[model samples]
Target: MESMTETEQRATRDQRARFEALARVVTEPLHRYLLRRAEPDQVDDVLSETLLVLWRRIEDVPGLEASGYVSGPAPDPDAVLPWCYGVARGCLANARRADRRRRSLLERLTWTVAGAARETGDADHTALHAALAQLRALDREVVLLWAYEELTPSRIAEVTGLSANAVSIRLHRAKKKLAAQLERKTGPHPGHETDEGQGTATGNGNGRSSR
Candidate 1:
């Protein structure tokens, strides 16, 4: 291989530094978001895709000052995290769809789970899943973003391309629907308690959380 010129070496170093800084800030938060939405085994793969997108689109990531300070009206974490989450959401969905296909193929091959135990061990999670399944896709997304991801409505607006008011409204309605579904399933006090309207998520149009 040819040796790198000094200029090339400097560029490489700068790129590495920027990537390291971005990863240091985003990796943990992105991983947490994926963990909330993705299957346990899928988290790593989804997170890798999210980070890859971040690196490839580094220039677009806001708040990276040339002086090594992530200074601006929007900090690196605030600007990058939600966008990373949007990317991670797509990664997770792709992973889940692939998993479903694989499972379908395995089922067709008559594979038995004689020793494999289902991971739906928690009753609360089971109810929650059932309730979430009942929601419209958009409503479900709003709910997951709000309750599970714990994103503010404005932040979710950034991720989902909805206005802040739209996000808040969707979140408010989604929570009520989810809570009602859980109550129906678990018969009152379903224990899938959600904190709706708990944030600055005020809007006229109702929305739900993300997942």
Candidate 2:
């Protein structure tokens, strides 16, 4: 291979520094995001794919356009994370699609083998998980993004490719649905109310109060 010129070497260094900064800020949150949506076995693989896409498309990450130099300030996590989450979401979907194909084949070949039941580790959240399962996939995703990721509607719009208004509407409806489901499971307490005015709800696990 030909030796890199001084300029090419500097460019390579800058790109590495930028990606390292981006990865440090996103890796944990991205892991949680994928863990919530993907199978335990697939989270690491899908997260690797997501980080690979982020490396390949580093220039497209928001707030990094001006950071071409290694010494420049790191990109803001708030500004960059939503876009990174979007990439992870896409990668997880691709993994799930491939998994479905493999699972279909396995099911055909092992029709006599009993499937294992899914277990939620926390007994407290069993009702919450069951309620989440009852939602339409898109609605459940909207709720997870709002509750677990703690994304604002606009940020969620960035991640999910829905318009901000649509995100707001979906989040509102999903919260009401979730509150109703949880109420039915454990009866309502006086203070346990959905924040309809602010578009928020509470649940036992992985859920956050919205501002």
Candidate 3:
């Protein structure tokens, strides 16, 4: 195993410093990415744009990216992230725009397929909706992107500002959490098939909080 060279070490430190600038000084509540999306479909769009912004402006950094020359207008100081939450926010806004052009009601990201064993009753759906509301924004985004939008990890990488590896890890964690949450609420999930929209999420017909 070779150790990092001097230049590489410095580069690593510099990268960390720059990331910190975006996360700490630039954006507030950096973790609060997905909740900002009003609708589930909005999450996919936002994640896509956010990743694009990160890749494009990464060399310059967001606010500091333009600090060297003041000739052009900057994206604004407040809009930064570990990579610039601006990317995330921008993605969200773009997703919102795209969603407007099409149906706004479909859960683009967090889709649920109802199992035959589980009745198509509104009660099952109602409980599922309530449980979904309880998830953190990050978890929700992961669930939607993987379960609903059906985007691949590389594609998800474009939205989340994370490498595909990171996206996979996050998604796995999100699923585990979601399953546990569902189990706790409904005893266990009933099986279901969700193709397109309007399917049932199965559970033991257990009650859930109306959060």
Candidate 4:
């Protein structure tokens, strides 16, 4: 292998540092987000897919300051984390689609095998799932991103390709709609009321927003 000059070595070190910083910031939260939405067994696989994309596009990971603080005027997390969520969103979607295809193939090949894979039921869980299913895709995403993932509307805007104001409005409306549906189905659980007028920013542990 060719020896790296001093400058080349420094540049390589900086790149690795930036990638590690992003991984440190995103790994746990990203995995949790995937876990909340994905089938339990596929969460790790989907998380691996998300991280693989991150590794492949390390140079393109945004918000890394040259000094490695990964911060700017607004905050490094705001810039970078949303972008990471966007990547994860796509990876999760692809994984789910592939899973469906695989299940379909299995069922076609052997009904007994496929029947054994059926998911177990819970009434509360089923009600929530049904309510969520009733929502339009965008509305469902806004609700899940806010309530389940604890993402702020601005961050969700980055992931869903909506304006911040749009995300806020959609999230607000979706919450009301979901609340109503759930109430009608199974009555309110404790603490079921939506927290209205919450600010658009609820900073995650790292103060990152979704992109």
Candidate 5:
């Protein structure tokens, strides 16, 4: 094998450094993103796949250019996170498709929110999961990206490939629908009591936990 020239060697080092920095900034949020969307068993594999794509496409990440060469400052999260989320979403979809191809229909049907909820035996969690399941797939995704990921409508648009206006509309409608569903399921005061006797589920009126 031929040895790399000095310039090529330097470029390779810079790329590694850049990727390390990017990974540091993105790995935690990306893990949370996957955990919310993927099966527990699949989250690690999907997160690895997502990070592999980020490594290969570091040049495409926004704010990376500003990080400079060789162990520079980390890229701004705001500038790159939406794009990173988009990458994870695609990777997750790919993993899901692959899993569907490998598993029998019976096996796939066993993987469900209701089944998981029953195992947890948490009434609030069960109600939340049931309510979320009622949403159209895309709308549920929008709400998760908003509430779980704490992304704005514009950022969700970047992640979901929808226009900002479309994301906003979906989020608004979905939140209302979720609120109504939770109220029906858990009563008008659809929340748990805190030590102070305050309702913890008064979560932005979106049927999500305020935490």
Candidate 6:
């Protein structure tokens, strides 16, 4: 490969210096945000991607962006960097995009699993599962993405092949339906027994009938 010209070398050094400084301020927060979006186990992968972006586009990284400071003897550059939130947010969006394509087929699978059944005595689990069984397909999928799979809306869209806005809307509606289900579960109707907001009883782990 051709050696970098002196001009390119100087430019690279300056850019590296700026990015070092940016990393000092953002290291902790960036890692924490990634941990939340992905997991502690995946933090390194996400962080690597974030830093790679910073390195590749150091020139594009304005003093106010994610460029690092010159390290060691290089005096702390008295320059304002881009809001760390912006950097982390962009990184998160990129990470989410990367997850989308891989999850496409799996996300297309049927929402309901044959194994999910009502639990006895655990009123909370029973109530929640009952509500899930009552939700519309799209809405239920969004709720499971967040609650069960621990995914953000962007990730959910990648799986569901829906837009982020649409995923958010469906999630909201799903949660509301879940809440309404719980409400009706306690609501008085003939043949339906109210637990009086106490603990409702079920039998065989699947029956809606009171014990």
Which residue segments of model 2 deviate by more than 4 Å?
1-4, 110-211
Task: Supply the TM-score for candidate 6.
Answer: 0.39
Task: Give one digit per residue, the lDDT tens place, for model 4 in 101-158.
Answer: 4444323212322222122122124555676689999988886676545578889999
Residue 160, model 3: lDDT of 77
Q: Rate the local accuracy (lDDT) of all candidates.
A: 0.64, 0.72, 0.52, 0.67, 0.72, 0.59
TM-score of each: 0.44, 0.48, 0.32, 0.45, 0.47, 0.39
Give the Cα error of residue 58 in candidate 2, in Å.
Answer: 0.6
Model 5, span 115-188: residue lDDT tens: 22222222225565687799999998997776556688999999999999999998778766766675566443
Off by over 4 Å in 5: 1-4, 66-71, 104-211
Residue 96 in model 6: lDDT: 64
Q: After superposition, how far is residue 120 of candidate 6 from its true place, in Å?
A: 28
Candidate 3 lDDT by residue in tens digits, 97-177: 654422221232123322211332322345445555677776667656765566788888898777999888877776555
Sum up the clashes in candidate 4. Answer: 5
C-alpha lDDT of candidate 5 relative to the true structure: 0.72
| Residue 193 lDDT (model 6) | 53
Judged by TM-score, which candidate is best? 2
Point out the higher-scoring one by TM-score: 2 or 3: 2
Off by over 4 Å in 4: 1-10, 66-75, 111-211
Error of 4 at 179 (Å): 47
Q: Model 1 over residues 1-211: C-alpha lDDT tens digits?
A: 6557976886666666777787888888988887887778678988998888777877776666543333323235876677777778887888877665444422321122221112222222555567668888887787666654568889899889999999888877766665566555544333333446455243433544333
Off by over 4 Å in 1: 1-4, 66-75, 111-211
Per-residue lDDT of 22-104 in model 6, one digit per residue for the tens? Answer: 67756676777777777454578777777777667656554444333443443223442344455556776766665553243
For residue 6, what is the lDDT in candidate 2?
75
Q: 1-211 in candidate 2: lDDT tens per residue?
A: 5556977887777788889988888999999998888878889999999999999998899877645545667678899999999999899889877665444423321222121111211223456567778999988887666654568899999988999999998877766666566557665455545656755566654566644
Give candidate 3's error at residue 72 in angstroms: 55
TM-score, prediction 4: 0.45
User: Model 1 reaches what TM-score against the true structure?
Assistant: 0.44
